[model samples]
Target: MADKQNVVSVSDRIPALKEQRKKRANRRLIFYLSIFFILIGIVVYFQSPLSHVQQIQVEGNYTGETREIIDQSALVSGESIWSQSLGSAKERVEQIPYIEEATIERSPDNITHYCPRTDRTAYLHNNDQFIPVYGNGKLMEEQSLDTYPSDAPIIFNWQNEELLEAFFVELDKLGSGMINHISEIHPSDDDPTLLRLFMNDGIEVETTIENFASYMAPYPTVARQISEPSDGILHMKMSPYFEAFNPEEYAGRFMKSTLIRVMVG
Candidate 1:
């Protein structure tokens, strides 16, 4: 009887050992699967299409060549998405002098989008010819209208990006629809300066740059303030603005002029 009891006990111990071995095998399988999935995730991240720039879009750009600018930026055409660093790419693109700010984003489809930012547009004067004027207020050499394509107004030569930027800010404050009839904007380089706007109605507004917001803050006031149809070039280059009854009369008139002598420092 004692021998039989011992045999049964041994049999039970065998099954228990087998059960323990099966649990160990399942644990090992789970461990290998976890590692495999992790490796796959890493491979997918590195191989994603977002790793390379697929599209480049430039908005509010006028004078700068879009393709040329993109080529100069930090974005490399082909690379692994996981290996590519977004912050590093942005820093590189922003290094280009013209691009004030840049933004990069990856779409759901894994395409990278690069956008270069610019606040102001260069208004090239078109008078049978096109003249490149920096948004700040510097007048670049005149080029043929065919070369520079834009409908922005022509102003006298000046080189102050800050002033032009201010004008844009003021325009935003006043609302663009207020100047629908405006054909051109001429800002003078003098104290108590003015922005001479030529309207399509054969009239012009001779208001100081400082008073521009207050005067044209409302759209309806523009037509009512046209005391007289401007006969010629309007001179807003003074404190108490006066219309150039004969604009041609002041053909080369300026209260102050800053002749830009380009010196690369």
Candidate 2:
């Protein structure tokens, strides 16, 4: 009787043991599936195309050769986005004189990136034609009227090349419209301290190197004061004012009238 009862108990426990083995197998499968998904995510993150830059686009460039400028600017090309830093790229590009500013961006897929470059256009009237001067003073010799960008204001002579360059930079600061209306700039190498300016609207401006912007700060209001663009010397040396000179009295119409005007006035 004892042997028969022991056999019955062993048979009853067989189904329970099988059920526990199935539960253990299911847990092992779930663990393997979780590890597989994590590996797939890491591969996708590291392998995407946004990893480096594939193309570079340059704009607002005149007189500068694109490939040469890019090389000089030290901008990297045909590399993964993940390898390049935007701040480092910007600093490198700014080293080029023609590029006033640069902006870099990466594509969403990490495969490609682009750089948009801006060039500051400064017009220098030389030999009867208006020539564009880059920030570094390089002359744009390309003679394409149709292909040329919009007209920039002609840089009239100030004191010297240095002073005139400085004046062109400070031009935007002054609200004076004369920069747009000016036709010619004649610098006196004799007294470079005095910048004699000629306007297209038939006027003369005599300003010095020190306070060009300050003198011209009130020029818009002062323009209303003049009936016509006075042909005489508008002296800014002593005070920001104008003096009409007789072309008949002076051999050359423009003169260093600072001493003459102060003595006469």
- For this target, which candidate reaches the highest TM-score against the unseen true structure? 2
lDDT agreement with native, every candidate: 0.53, 0.57
Candidate 2 lDDT over 1-265, as tens digits, reads 9999999999999999999999999999999999999998867866865444566655555544567555654546556556667677667766655556766655643322133433334466555566665544445555323332344545444335676666555554543354555445555666665566655556677676567667755555555567665446655444556676656565543662333342212
Tell me the TM-score of each prediction against the true structure.
Answer: 0.58, 0.58
lDDT of 1 by residue, 4-118 (tens): 9999999989989999999999999999999999999877766776445455455545655666555655455565444456677667766654456667665432434354443
Candidate 2 deviant stretches above 4 angstroms: 1-35, 41-80, 83-92, 96-98, 110-121, 125-150, 155-165, 175-178, 236-238, 256-265
lDDT of 2: 0.57
Query: Highest lDDT, which number?
Result: 2
